[model samples]
Target: MTDTLTTLRAQLLASVAVIDEALKAVPPEAVQLDLPKPAAFFDRLRGRLWPRMSVSQVQGCERILAACGHAGFGLAWTAYVLATAYHESGYRMQPIKELGGDAYLSKYDTGRLAERLGNTPEADGDGVLYAGRGDVMITGLDNYVRATVELRRLGIIGEDVDLAKTPERVLEPAISAAILIYGMRDGWFTGRGLDDLLPRTGSATVGQFTKARPIVNSMDKAAPIAGYAIDFQAALFAGGWA
Candidate 1:
């Protein structure tokens, strides 16, 4: 038993050393996004999709790229994520609260949807309070609870954080990028994940991109998002995608 313990200790030390080497091999700049053709790529979307592009949009894209960090999501999945963010936030590319303010957001406070969302109808104003927030627009008490768990499970947030109570924390660019990245990757929004629609081995075709709408929403504006994904894929390749 003493010999076994000594062997186990040596194995763990070796494993940790290998992990340290692997981490060192991937420098910080390895994750930083340097768009090779920002003018030729995103500029195409400038007047056509977004009225005007800003530094915040570029920062948001970089945040997502950093959060992704060699996840083997491939160019297709990466582009799809960018497309989802584009459509979901109306091309703002930043975390945004759902429009319509309190009155419109109150819709989540009533009916069966409210029950599923863990909303207390006509009490506490949880619908408006925890209303859709983030690049992925994580909405409702139920989603907040789930996002909090996912964020914490991935070590992106502290155990002291409770998203349902402080939903606005999702607005932070890093937090928002994490939510969008893992939310779609893990299927937090719907039962369908990125791998579900676009398998790891298979390439994402135009039709597949349209079908991938379920990864976030249920076929809402599928066509336009697909178009965006195709365009975004070009940008990813320009950035030296593997």
Candidate 2:
């Protein structure tokens, strides 16, 4: 890692550890209720949480912060995105064809025809179908199709590449992370800065994301590129960028 990245990583890790400690003190239910609405309260939480995200999460935060030009806004953005992921994929794995296996893609789709049915789900195999994709949490093939085209257009991913055949592209943390960033950039669904607000909003602030439409739009335009770069760097660190 570059000196700047290393320094930033240490700082971020330090902050996240502190935040984790603080969060541990507060029950998940309490954390959920401490939503920041007022500027004063939001600022207080922001100041405390800004330095508390994990290094990786902070790296993601830095990318958003630079894109939005507001440190406070970035935390909100992160929370929104991660919360969506929690809602969509739980930061855990989903059992869809894209992330689960080739057999998860249903046989009755254009994607299967496009892939020449290279892979199909069998009744005896991975039975789950219609997995989610990208950040802001896109679900089903319809959404993935839209995002694949968008990623191709943005040069973040390749066009004509079969999303079904490459499940790793959907599940790889780096790829998944980048796509979340990219989807936000592409105005996926709301195109809101959910990832940025994740920290300040906490669990209780789920309703706030619905209110911040413009910030979401801005994040939608910028997150893909920034996330792609950061995720790629992270992939390199994990020896998976190639």
TM-score, per-candidate, Cα-based: 0.80, 0.38
For model 2, how does the per-residue alpha-carbon lDDT over 189-209 read when each residue is reduced to its tens digit? Answer: 454444443344223232445
lDDT of 2: 0.42
Q: Ten consecutive residues with minimal summed lDDT in candidate 2? A: 233-242
Stretches off by above 4 angstroms in model 2 are: 1-75, 91-129, 133-136, 164-168, 190-207, 210-242
lDDT values, one for every candidate: 0.80, 0.42
Which residue ranges in model 1 land beyond 4 Å of their true spot? 1-31, 34-52, 201-203
Q: What's model 2's lDDT at 55?
A: 47
Q: What is the C-alpha RMSD of each candidate to the true structure, in Å?
A: 11.4, 15.3
Model 2 RMSD vs true structure: 15.3
